[model samples]
Target chain A: MPMSPEAQALLKAARKHPDRPSDEARTRMRRNVMRAVSAGAGAVGATTAGTAAAQTLFAKIAGGALVVAALGGVVVGGRALFSSSESSVDPKNAPASTSTSTTVVGTSRETSEALGSTSTAANLDPTSDRVVASSALRTTATPSASSVASSPRIATAPSKPAEANITSDAASAPAVESVDVLKEEAALLASAQSALGKGQAARALELTNEHETRFPKGALSFERRAVHAMALCALGRGTEGRREAQAIVDRAPGTPLAERVSAACP
Target chain B: MPTPNALRSVNAPSAAGGVIPVAATRGSRSTTPPKTFDDLYDDHVDLVWRALRRFGVSEPGLEDAVQEVFIVAFKKLDTFEGKSALSTWLYGIAAYVARNVRRSQRRRPETPTEDAGLHLTSASDSPEDEVGAAEALRVLHALLDELDDDKREVFVLAELEGLTAPEISTSLGVNVNTIYARLRAARAAFEQAVVRRRAKDARQLQKGGLPCR
Candidate 1:
């Protein structure tokens, strides 16, 4: 069944007018890919020097807010006490960033400031359904005075068994669903971090275990694993903690997160 | 077109450890050892971008879709065993990403249909040629939308992208015979569609509408 000449001509014309990504988009996406690649590409052990260069690049590109996001996860998790709702946080009522773009790198200081108060406020109402807004995730990522002010909720949340809260809704698109997933991921990791802070290493490990089950490839997985490693260290499981932390350090050397992970169980 | 290393089987990276070193190539031969990840991005970004469009990824989500593909590629860079052309491996990734994007789009309350093919960039210098090319592309997309996902993919890869049957096989992970079967069915469906469209245009021309190209 050969295509007629007319069909062939149509394909040729369509090919001539094929869609292309604009220069700005191409460059932005390239930078993003490079950043992510640099963080983990070196783990292959194929290029030691390349890995060294990647480490430097990772340090350069991983803005201050990224480190905060990691540290903030700990701060926010410490305060979040899980209550009733098993549903994933709704992206519809999520911060304005969720509707427009899936990822709003929350680099601005104002955004970071807002996150601290927002997470604290959300934690204040354990009775209300805990909504994981994009800002709340940012709060977990970027530590603020307000986030730190909120005392640990490890006493309240661990009394009940941890529930799966990241079940994504079919009504939401991936962009919105990602926001929801990130929120749930942040909440889980935040609670785990909080547990570690309150000397409840077992509770922290439990939350991280729940996180692993819900979001195996979650955006904040690195932080979750880091907290998991820390929890292991706190529980006197030094060998396991050291091994876990070493892999993360190997995968992304020089980054602040890896540096912190390396300190685990030492 | 089958890339020079079309038949190469990419060995999935070992559990222990081994790097998937990239190789750079010119027209039909290897020119240099595989360059940096940046080189891979430079060489194949357009292929991934257009392939995503052809695969029905909506324009609004296209950027994220492309990023997702590269991110996966970057994470799985060690999996590149050179078993297939780098482009083929990337295409396979694009196909998967596009499907997910579409699936998500469908779940939305209002699926956006603003993807007018007329906005596609035209290579023609003259206004008349540009209009003709745009109309042709519009017609092409209309026909393509009628086919099922499987046949549509085979048609796009075979007719528009010009990947040989074997190359499409490797990209799609479908058997060669199956690729041939879908391509044949898609061509026949496309030809019948073109004939119907031409007839409709002729009727419209008689009714005092613009001339059919």
Candidate 2:
């Protein structure tokens, strides 16, 4: 639709003109760029560039000429190993897209899955996987009695305050007996939080589910539930999100966890 | 593979200054001096700065963002074919960098924007006009903020910056037709925003100062 003449003029009047950087700002930026360049960080786009630049600085400071002849025999011996690895890299120069592609969507499932596969062996059973967030009845010994006390029904409060109490209550709660498991689960839950922070809702969902499977009675239940609800909302499944939010509200209405879920899933 | 005529075309005077001396001096030397990152920076710094702002980078982050864009450009300059204008290439880099910064900021939500001076004016305007113009700019930015990132980028390029559809397509990495559709939605949204602002302003004028204050 064509904007009305008056509306067009209204917006046109406010159109920002090109910005001019102050001389100080320009000088500062130039100084920064020059510093980065002189440090040889600009040689090969990011990733390995930092390592290569460090190597260059090391070569300079160590007086390589003095040691080159002495080290020649060892260098020649290792040449085959270094040469094989170096051959895989393109010599034409670093590609611009190198740094661009490294950003993960939400959770890097590979890391989470790797952590899950290797470390999860010591984890509790995946019986919690059968526990749909909707069930609200499976109080099956999730170490957090504080959480079960709040609601035997909702999958909220998988993250915070009660997290420490989860360890204190661990002596009585036989389902989750070790503080080490709680710490490991907290770290895994943090990865899901990171993924959610990156707007990776699906990845967050996976990691949240993984946390539940590994530590169904995990301490960070509040944290994981909040993240799970937010992830659902972010993925546009608002009804599911609202249900989780309702549970958080019903279970722990005053805590930050409930507040976050209420705000997001609302 | 620029002909003398084509070289002459790009060498035409620019709004910022005179022609960028990249390919124009062709016949002189095979060493027509490969374009340095600084040359790209000098020629298109203003373009990068403005585009980044439109992409929702805060004023405080703009300086670091510009340097980051160029550092990437510096490393990747070897692969830049002249198929698109240098501004287009730089805009693409600036857009990606700005979007990433905004996404990262959203993830943390703790690093707050400290640049409240975005609407403060130098005495270039008379006292009366300064308030109105600054308020208008603030309102426009607020409305721009309400737009989705993609719509905001398209709107800023096409409407405010006067970039053509094809140019925006290249800059934003969208299909040309997609650019038009987005532009249409953007214009509609912008127009509605302006109308909404007018209603608010009309109601508030009776109460005195701009609502932006």
Candidate 3:
């Protein structure tokens, strides 16, 4: 007997009934949404904070470099020395004349003989020695001395602080956990697909049911429904399968699962 | 339903008409001290969920797509001009996200059984015909499972969503003519499947077996 138009229309309407989100489900979604938003906001804040801290660090490094360069210039300038004529000609300032002069002459002659073979001995003269001592005093006066002493300390500072901050920040950051959830959902979907491939409709349905329980809002739900519809079709329960597939499509129009549902029913 | 020409007029690029008036500049009014990410989620939660449903995104993928859509929107919110409705913009994002999900699924080698089309239209019926209509729709859904994703989408958007061809073209980034052609093919395919299913069920009933319906 030919089916009445009324029957066909009735079936369509029943299939079209919008699946309402349960209150508990809605509450969970609201929470998930809140969690996702918080995670996003935290990510943004962390990125901004990281950039600002890096800029401050770079500025400090540049300032320290400039100070080091200035100290280097002072050291180079102190090395070149030119004596005045007065120091060489002042007799009163010179060693005692005669016997004292003879003793001085003997010592000077011996010093010159020793220095003739070594330019290093010539630089060890009192004037040069005085310059070297003054240069050393100036080097010790600047922050460069402390900076050099603290180089190892500075090298370790950033890493130690960063490790601590990262630990604390990770602890404080909001957990979205979407990726993990998605992975689990994807795995279930894969298993369901595998079961369907093996021609085990019941197993497929079980996997889909599990997925539905865990991820009610998952796109996989529609796909699972489609699989159920296929199973129904195989069992000669085409009407029920068709309805389930239609519900999936109606609930999630553009999803791959909807396509699956539609195909199975067709 | 609006005629195609009328829809065209409504969607025409005009200085005053095509633009949806917004209550405030889309991103500028965020004077509420930057919302904790949680606040943004709360604000658009329903919008995202509804849009995903409208787009026919399935349950398993729905949450991820929802999260992605909002994240993308938040990151790019600064670029949103106040000219268009925020919901529309978000819907556009949801559509894109849903499409991407489908594409990724396609790349994997899956069983042929995984292939199913989406049914867009509800068979018209009075309240008195509810039960039978429901059964028929279930059959219809099963039949839809044979269609490819592309055909399924075209049918859903054009018939169920009641979006005009041009609107679908814009949403899917396809040519308008392509939408029309796809719709025609999808409808034909669906009708043929339904007729075959009905015939099979009738045969089974005549053979002393219970009709699956």
Q: Which candidate is the best by lDDT?
A: 1
User: For residue B152, what is the lDDT in candidate 2?
Assistant: 85
Residue ranges of candidate 3 with Cα displaced over 4 Å: A1-16, A44-266, B1-92, B99-140, B207-213
lDDT per residue for candidate 3 within A1-266, as digits (tens), equals: 23346334533353355333444434444433332322222222222222332222111222221221111111111111101111121222111111110111222223222211111111211112121111111111122222222111001111122223223333333333432333244445545555665577777778777877886654233344555677676556788888887776665455444565567677
How well is each residue in B80-185 modelled by candidate 1, as lDDT tens digits? Answer: 4455677777777777666655665565567445333222122112223777776666666766766777887898888888889998898777899999999999
Overall local distance difference test of candidate 2: 0.48
Candidate with the larger lDDT of 1 and 2: 1
Worst 10 residues of 3 chain A by lDDT: A150-159
Error of 3 at B127 (Å): 7.7
TM-score of every candidate relative to the true structure: 0.50, 0.45, 0.38
DockQ for every model, please. 0.14, 0.12, 0.04
Candidate 2 docking class:
incorrect
In angstroms and one decimal each, the interface RMSD of every candidate reads 15.1, 18.0, 31.3
Which ranking of candidates, highest TM-score first?
1, 2, 3
Scored against the true structure, residue A8 in model 2 reaches a CA lDDT of: 52
Model 3 over residues B1-213: C-alpha lDDT tens digits? 222222222322211111211122223224332323344455556656645544545444455445456544543443334334444455555666555555544544552542122122223324235554444444444565455656666665555545678766655557889989998887777666666655655565577654222
Docking class of 1: incorrect
What is the alpha-carbon lDDT for the whole of candidate 1? 0.51
Q: Which model is ahead, 1 or 2, in terms of TM-score?
A: 1
Name the top DockQ candidate: 1
Q: Rate the local accuracy (lDDT) of all candidates.
A: 0.51, 0.48, 0.40
